[model samples]
Target: MSRAIRRNSLTEQATDALLDYIAERQLGEGDSLPPTGELAATFEVSVPVIREAIAALSGIGLLRRQQGRESVVAAPGATHLSRLLTLRVAHAAVEDDAIQQYREVVEVGSARLAASNRSEESLRELDDALADLRAVADDESLHAADIAFHAALARASGNDLFVLTIDALQPLLHRLRRRVWSGWVNSGGDLTSIVEAHATILERVRERDADGAARAMTDHLAQARLGLDVLSGHVGDSPARD
Candidate 1:
């Protein structure tokens, strides 16, 4: 009745064992991991194997390589997720479609949280992001504001998971926004409309209208997607789109 990850190789097993080691010790962020030799001895593996596992862990942002060639536990963050999302969007796999869908769900939840839990400082931050959006004279500046505003909104949600998810989605969101905005620009959708949609979401959040905030976010994303010429997946897998 033991359902466990079937370790297909020594390195795979060592990776799992290292995760277990961290969990068992309740290692806090920045806590020093056992020395490479100690870990190797505990796992009954060569130092090379332990080093391999540590490398893998670092790649995923779960472990930090400190100065003086030391390793420490790391607080989970979005760096790994951001890299993977950037690659996934660039490759345009079928699963890439699901990421857009996943974002909608996460962002809607975040919007509701922002409406319910936002602080005055968070509202001011949102206002600053909006002012930046209105001041943008070019698509590039608009895109920068677009990224910042959503990030601010997520932080206002008072949920760490929401903040991290929004952070990780930044690159992909930027790509999608660029694509959508280009099509919208050619088709007569103006930056003012985009700014207005976001303003509605912000106003709802400021008013503490949770339902209104969620609905506003959903509508905003739908409109943004609608502006895209075609929902093409994969760069070369499909015909070139505008």
Candidate 2:
């Protein structure tokens, strides 16, 4: 039996109740939700209230609605997460350093996983992205290739969540990278070492050397940290590239 929602905040309470119901029932992506009429009865609310609640859930990527079909559970992808993250950043709820640190943890783990689970197709994709990165000179071209390379690396991890998360964060990460690139250019640094770092990581993944891949990624991120600091307006001598 569903618990009755309080009347004080019908839509908000119904939304919370629906979320609890989904979790209690262990609903997975694509599981069809009960019809709005049925949900209204279950929550002891009016049908219109239930509709509004469903709309609220759909707004946050928790539900998918069809014109005449029942709504289904949704798998929050890059678009949804990016929207939420952008909102949080705009409100100053999250800072660039927090984003950078989170990426380092996820990406290092992704490198290790990719070394063990990467497929030939993913390897080829990474190689192509790296090739493009090596060849691109303009910031726009480099940004596109850089994003592709990171996305490919995360995809190679064979974890959908990692792929979703890194993809969502790429826009934020690009801002940091752009700052780093601008500083590097002004300081007369070349792209050779950056390309070399990625090559080493891909080679380690190809050899199935999980530990080596992890270490290489750690080193690469350490270099990126220098640029991220610069982005945060911490002026200092640029870190030397190998």
Top model number, TM-score? 2
Models 1 onward score TM values of 0.85, 0.86
Q: Write the per-residue lDDT of candidate 2 for residues 31-125, one digit (tens) a residue.
A: 99999999999999999999999999999899999999999999777999988888788798676678778878999999999999999999999
Q: State candidate 2's TM-score.
A: 0.86
Question: Number of backbone collisions per candidate, in order?
Answer: 0, 0
Q: Which runs of model 2 end up more than 4 angstroms from their true locations?
A: 1-8, 26-28, 231-242
- Candidate 1: regions farther than 4 A off: 1-7, 67-69, 89-99, 229-242
**Which is the leading candidate under lDDT?**
2
Please state the error at residue 83 of candidate 2 in Å: 0.3
Model 1: lDDT to the true structure: 0.83
Per-residue lDDT for 29 in model 1? 91
| Tens-place lDDT digits, model 1, residues 131-168 | 99999988889999988999999999999888887899
Which residue pairs show collisions in model 1?
none
